[model samples]
Target: MANPTACLLIIGNEVLSGRTRDANLQFLATRLGELGIPLREVRVIPDVEATIVATVNEVRAKYDHVFTTGGIGPTHDDITSECVAKAFGVPWVVHEETRALMAEDYARRDPPVEMNAARMRMATLPLGAVPIRCAMTSAPGFTMGNVHVMAGVPRIMQSMFEALAPSLTGGVPVVSRAVHAIGVFEGNIAEALEAIQKRHPDLDIGSYPFYRPTPGSTGFPGGGVALVSKGVSLAEVEEATAEITAMLAAMGATPIQGEPG
Candidate 1:
């Protein structure tokens, strides 16, 4: 059976404009990998309403789960909640519990303040969606169908995701292994690597090159291709990695158990 799949929809004008570098995709991908939900794709778009709606609907329909980050804050530019609501044809409404939580949190601050419209905006959500709680900021995210809207801030987004994680069911976690070799050229090993991949089609094998800065030396460090594998079965991943190691040994390159740190 196929494993549960997820897609990330990153929304923010700052991200598109290069003002704010995104940090959520890698975090979510790693967490989901541990949970066995493979993140199949990622799309980064601006805060455009129509584009967000279209993309949210597309990915939500195609994948088992859809995660959205950014554009859910209190500012005017934060429009992901509304776009996601539009995508699902749902009316956006104020989640009363979230509003109350925000109100209480604001009231408890050292400089007690009113829950103004701007702050209240954080409590709004698409009607019928369940709130994804955020302990740090009283402003919470929400879940609509397969779509999960989260905060743009890395810290708050992480908190909201933790709240929603227990509710999500995941498939068997993929077993991951890596076989590395130092100073082995990709061009020289391409043929052997292709044969090994063909032999173990079930494994998700990836070859990545690494670099290390040697100040005194002019050349890139003995960095080489890493043959990483992921599969439902540990034995299969290990077997494929072993074959790659054997291939490297035959080609006079020592295969290391892990990549260079």
Candidate 2:
């Protein structure tokens, strides 16, 4: 099956300045993987209109799907919608549906909904775009020309992504299983692990090492290693997991069945 290609654009000065660590990339990456979509590239840009527009246009032209996170909040710095509109060469205006949603949400507050101009700005959208609503936030997202505009807030972005999953074109789901090795560092078994990965070119094999209190020791987490394999077929993951597990055991190490909780 053909893999559905996607590119991610993270727009925020907070993330770039190290003020906030991005959570959307990992969330979207795993979620897309589950839906059989492989993320091809990711870019992080400051909340600048010119840069956002350029990156949006670039990714939309290159990938089957382009997902953007951040810069959609109800603040002056938020400009993703306008930038997207400009990139698509479409008119930008206050979207009535989004305004209604925002108004209704604001009405639920202790005080009556204040129709402030800044809050109203959150309702603007690009011309000929579809509204992407979410329960997490009232600011609606938009989809135009394969570009999906989502919220800067991680929760709202995730909700929008979930709602839009049905519209995405994806390939076979990627399935994976992990094998754990106790008392063995990653380097000791790196050669065998690399061999298994080489033998299965179609499968993606990864080795992750963790140091924690020892498993058998009380209050002290165990430090161990994990081998994970992902592919289009469950059988492929299972086969790779089995082979790698056997290899680790033969090297005088204990291969645990699953990754530690």
Candidate 3:
């Protein structure tokens, strides 16, 4: 059977404004791949309620699983939880268990912090949502239907995902093989690469050019093209990689196994 597909929604104004770079997409993509859920689409939107609600509704119907990160904090702009609730047409309510947990933790603070309205906001979730708890914080992310909401902080997000991963269903994990053609420009092998891709239509064949500056030689920065073949079947990936290796050798370039250095 084909692996389940997933979509990631990164919600934050800081990300769009370039004030904070998004660090969750790559991590989620890689981890989802390992769990046999291919991350097929990603959308980065500001903390606009309409946009977040519309995007959440759109992608949740399109993909088997949906992950959202950001805007679940105490600040005013942190509105992803409410937006998601709106998307699901569920009333946003406070989760008592999470609120109780947070209250307990806050009581143990050095200064005995109070669970103010802002801090209590983190415990609020969509009606009927299941809390996704992590060790990093008392406040929890939640799972509402197929959508898994997580914190935007990389460390906290990763912990939430780790806690939630075991419950997820998966299929055969996708695999990849790569060969770097040293000293070969992409133009030198574009036609051959296209031919290879045509021959293996089931696999994803890609050529990426990179520059690796030689220690002392200032000659064109010394780079090459990397040919990667990705698929669910290891045999198919190996077969396509072998063809790529042969193509590079035919062009008089040494094909180095794996990624470019």
Residue-by-residue lDDT tens digits, candidate 2, 1-261: 478789999999999999999999999999999888889899999999899989998899999899999887778899998899999999988888778878888898887779699887778889899988777777788798899989878888899999888888788888889888767887788888899999899999998887787556764246777789989989878999999978987887778887676
Can you list the residue pairs that collide in candidate 2?
Answer: 70-152, 212-221, 213-220, 213-221, 213-222, 214-221, 214-222, 215-222
- Evaluated against the true structure, the overall lDDT of model 1 is 0.87
Clash count, one per candidate? 0, 8, 0
Best by lDDT: 3
Runs in model 2 lying further than 4 Å from the true structure: 104-109, 213-222
lDDT of 3: 0.92
Off by over 4 Å in 3: 213-221
**lDDT per residue (tens digit) for residues 1-261 in model 3:** 788999999998899999998999999999999899999999999999999999999999999999999999998999999998899999999999999999999999999988999998999999999999999999999999999999999999999999999999988888999898778888879998999999999999988888888898875457888799998889999999999999888878889998655
Give TM per candidate: 0.96, 0.90, 0.96
- Candidate 2 backbone overlaps, count: 8
What lDDT is reached at residue 73 by model 3?
96
lDDT of 2 at 184: 80
Tell me the lDDT of model 1 at 257. Answer: 87
